[model samples]
Target chain A: MKRTASPSFAIYTPDSSLRQPLRLVGAMFRDLSSGRELAWRLAVRDISAQYRQAALGLLWAFALPVANALIWLFANASGVVLIRDTEMPYPNYVFTGTMLWAIFLEAANAPLQLTTAAKPMLAKINFPREAIIVSGIYQTLFNAAIKVVVLLPALLFLGVQPSGYLFLLPVAVMTLVFAGTAVGLFLTPVGLLYTDIGKTFPLAMQFMMYLTPVVFPIPAQGIAATIFRINPVTPLIQTARAWLTGSLGTDLVAFGLVNLGTVLVLFLMWVIYRAAMPILIEKMSAS
Target chain B: MSDPLIKVENVSKKFCRSLKRSLWYGMQDLGSELLGRRHGDNSQLRTDEFWAVRDVNFELGRGECLGLIGRNGAGKTTLLRMLNGLIKPDTGRIEMRGRVGALIALGAGFNPVLTGRENVYINAAVLGLTKAETGRHFDEIVAFAELEAAIDSPVQTYSSGMTVRLGFAIATTLQPEILILDEVLAVGDANFRHKCYHRINKLMTDAAVILVSHNMDAIAQTASSLALMDGGAMTVFHEPVEGIAAYHDANAQRQATTSDGGTTHQCYAPVVAAEVRILPAEVGYQGQLTVEAEITCDADLPEILISFTATNAYEQAVMCWHSSRHPSPLGLCKGRQLLRFSVAPLLLDNGSYHWNFKITRRGSLEHVVWLTRHGPLVVKSRHRTLGNIPYLPDASQCEHRMLTSP
Candidate 1:
């Protein structure tokens, strides 16, 4: 039989009805509002469940990054890796940098974590899937909230003066979040299909961190320095570091350009997610 | 009837057999969507792929209950998933006007580390309930699940039955406009199943329900109308009983045609053909079975063993009788001959059974022919209300026995 539809009922098919780009953009705004409440609920669910069985509970959120920071501090002190000199105490610098990077890591990992946890629901339930994405991000931010507790005290202990452009820190941190999440959202469809993406992503992120100015300042000159300069994330990380330590870098223009590029990439990825998520969910579940 | 709350029109879905091709197809589908290109003809079967659901059509109006009865791989789950909007139809459309809640997989959304109460709230929100709504109904849900004491415990600590009870309670209490249940009732105990049926009946007063289950009695009891699904296509029946009977008929056909593979023993004798027919279509408890067979042989045979084996619903052989085991043996004529045998009442269980008829040479591996699945025998129970009563219990027939006196 041929396709048939009544005026009262909306039809669904493998082929999505062609919608204008403007309509899709409008739908995203509408979806965000509708999905926000559920996202908060899911975030609460995730946070409670994450620590329900653990003895240390939410402390692990702070503990994990602090532990990594200490390991790096010792390595630099013993001259194991020889991180470049900085004006601030190296431990505090490493801790602050780690904190910012942790937020970026959370944002980058949000899409994969959300889709994996929601796979069963995706197969059976038909609720707003955007809620999963929003919840994942909210959970990331919630974990980062605990990091702020340590951050304020560490800055005081290190005796570092605040930058006059300290208010711009939010803008810098947001750029890191957006850039990381844009890359993650772009990988979500691929990750759901080929689990190789999930297994290899953490290793890839670890490698990319070396290219960014996460643990050390960008080198002055060398092949590695050139690679770091070309890296988009280097400006974002350095900008946040510069804002936190009261040392404004000369790469403010590059940082602004990177933020602008991150926004555009995020918008493109959001559009791709809207178009591709349902198809990916369907295929993943059926397989 | 008022306009259907859920309208499903000629919905079809395709699935690939190989994992590699399935992933490739997924990528291609996603690429097409990004490019705003229409999907290619999915109705045309590709290599290593077939339609899981094909040209299925149905409508569910408010206050209506529709039952989907089929065997495994019959596409009922696929159809329900499409209606729930978990997936889109490959060829057609499914449109619903109201919020749809599906219990396609029980405990599917539960997080093991979350408390039962917490899981219920999240599950309610997943079904579109707000936080305030979930809070308002939290006690009611826990009460319905009878998990008051254990509601605070992590879901991982609860048994499978408790998990399903919680899942069911949340879905039903949410009072969705359209409810889709798929084999969920099979997991819980009898008491919970009864409660579920009661809740579903109450839900159908306002919302439409689509139920897919293997239990014929449940379908017959609950469905306002029924749909039979076989090999992906759907045929709706006006009467639930008729739909159930058609399901059994289709199952019988499926049973008879399934390949048994190459035979280990072959008959050297030249045999033309064989036919078997049951004397009566329906047999009651302790009723005589008269099996008639007509076999044509090229040469006269000394004695041919005519045997029939009756197997229960579980495919367990309940009875085996052969002409050679009889007190007096019989011989077949040279040409076509009709033979009839009257045996004692089988006294087997009261359920559907398959009677397999076979012809073989006496005391030899050589065989004439074999009909693996001859036909179904609907055996009636002495207790008219009971179905599938295996054997008469060895208990005393007395209604009451005094074990102790005050």
Candidate 2:
């Protein structure tokens, strides 16, 4: 339904209404549709700036994760960390899993990185601030596309044929992004105030990867398996892998609940972000 | 008319000096917003916090300009930010009818690593332009900045003037209905600054402009109304001249109270009656400016310097005269002293001006009495001047000047 603002002009204050969640959702939809060109421009700026004067440029995007997956593969093969057998080749399995994890990581980092980078602009210009987030997501997706270029070729070389459930890959990726960004949006305000979160996020994410079954199969009965079950990202990563291979996961209920929880939590995060952004911006600029 | 295009009502903003307390307060504010609680009174400031802008009320109609002038941290920039929607006020509201274009800082959104051409696109987008819109005006923007040769070069390589030119060009392209300009003339060369003033004058016919500048001349030339801000409070003057006078008075008072010599030393102000008169009615005919003052001092004083500064209507210095420049030392004594001064063959064109008078210690910078905008002097013009500027030089001097004399 098309919604019209009762008052065309807006009055803003530090203590203004958060607006109804429904109204915020409506505004987000409006900005996404109308401000698409601006978002595209901002994304293009980031991509061009990121690649300019660089020797390797965009290749570094895929190269980093490829190196990461290779380390785990070598560890398992050397019997340093024994891995459970999988239906697909271990290299292809690890590659896709690590590549998907990278996407989540980028999505999780987008809010803080984009907001920090745009601080000066935000303090002076008054455009739709949400364009920053939209542009950030677009940049993250572009980076993921670079990773897919290598991931696709690796899958083909490993002779892993595409499965019917491969069509669900986009949905699975969406769930991962939504879940990751939900936590990111919730923490963005805190990160804006304290630099510690931004400084330690990469290290924290590295440790978090071990708790999820990214390279190895989930053990049936062990402390590792219990951690995997409890971890919020487990269902997302497992389901994405199941879709990539022909084998579907055993627990459909867990997948549904995780997806549902992700959507709810993401909506809540959007509410918090909308309410806190102005206050955060005012404080950040003053300091 | 038709309700003002911009209305700022009792707007206030508070700022905290401590980062930790600011963050905590922000979180608490956010929680209150989520819970739909009423905002507490913002006029009362807590420790480590102060109101950046308080109870600022004003309105602007279409085609009107409001000039904001204040010392640093008086909340002029903060008020502009609120009007531009970059920051929300802590109390009251700012309502406006159309798009707001702000050039609050030069090169504010430009990426240093990006070429000027690329930065133009991003900055236009940041100012609310679509990709196609920016593309359509791309050539014009570059032309306006006069940076066609350097368009492909990285912005970091550009000089500060070049950066400001490009930023101004991009920001003004939208011709927004409500434009907020903050200290844009603080950079750029004289020629470009004049061009900017001309361009802004063109935009003034249809837009409501909120201008914050330290250049008194810029304010007086462009603004129909003026606001004087101090300590987070604002007083608006509908008449441009009155506003300028109030600004000068406040500024003089502030200087008197804060200057080390003025505040620390014991001194007395000699009462004086001052008046300024222009001779021959019109300029360009060897007109003269005369100033007369009757000074009465309680006790005899030696070695006092009496100085006069002539400022144009915009409060820019046109000329200065000092008794100390003479071979004989000017002195003050008990009872009354009558002083008369005249500058014959005044070079000023037809204009209204304010005369600033100062009495200081002969050898030191210490001001005994500083009277700002003491009186008005009016000079009429019978014939047009040689050039656009008010200063007029002798015809023989202008005519005899050789093209390659150097």
Write down the RMSD of all candidates, one decimal each.
9.2, 9.1
lDDT of 2 at B26: 76
> Which segments of candidate 2 are over 4 A away from where they belong?
A1-8, A13-15, A19-22, A85-88, B39-43, B106-108, B259-406
lDDT of 2: 0.75
Q: Give lDDT: candidate 1, residue A89.
A: 74
Kindly list the per-residue Cα lDDT of model 1 for residues B1-406, writing each as its tens digit: 8988888777788888898999988898788788887654536877888888988888889988899988888888778777766676778767787666666655556788888887887787776667777788889889989999999898999998899888888777656677787777644788877888788777667778888887776777889999999889999998998898888777666655766421122234566767778877578777888888877778877876878888765445777788877777667667898988875676776677777777877778776877764457777766433444346545676678789999
DockQ of each: 0.34, 0.29
**Alpha carbon lDDT of residue B51, candidate 1?**
81
**Model 1 regions lying over 4 Å from their true place:** A1-10, A85-89, A163-167, A247-249, B259-406
Model 1: per-residue Cα lDDT over A1-287, one tens digit each? 01011112345666653456776676677667767777887889888877876899988777877887888989998989888766567876788878888888889999877888788777777666778788877777777767766676788678878668677777777777778788889899888888999999999988888787777766888999999999998788777877877778778999989988998998888888877777776675642
Screening candidate 1 with a backbone cut-off below 3 angstroms (N, C-alpha, C), the clashing residue pairs are: none
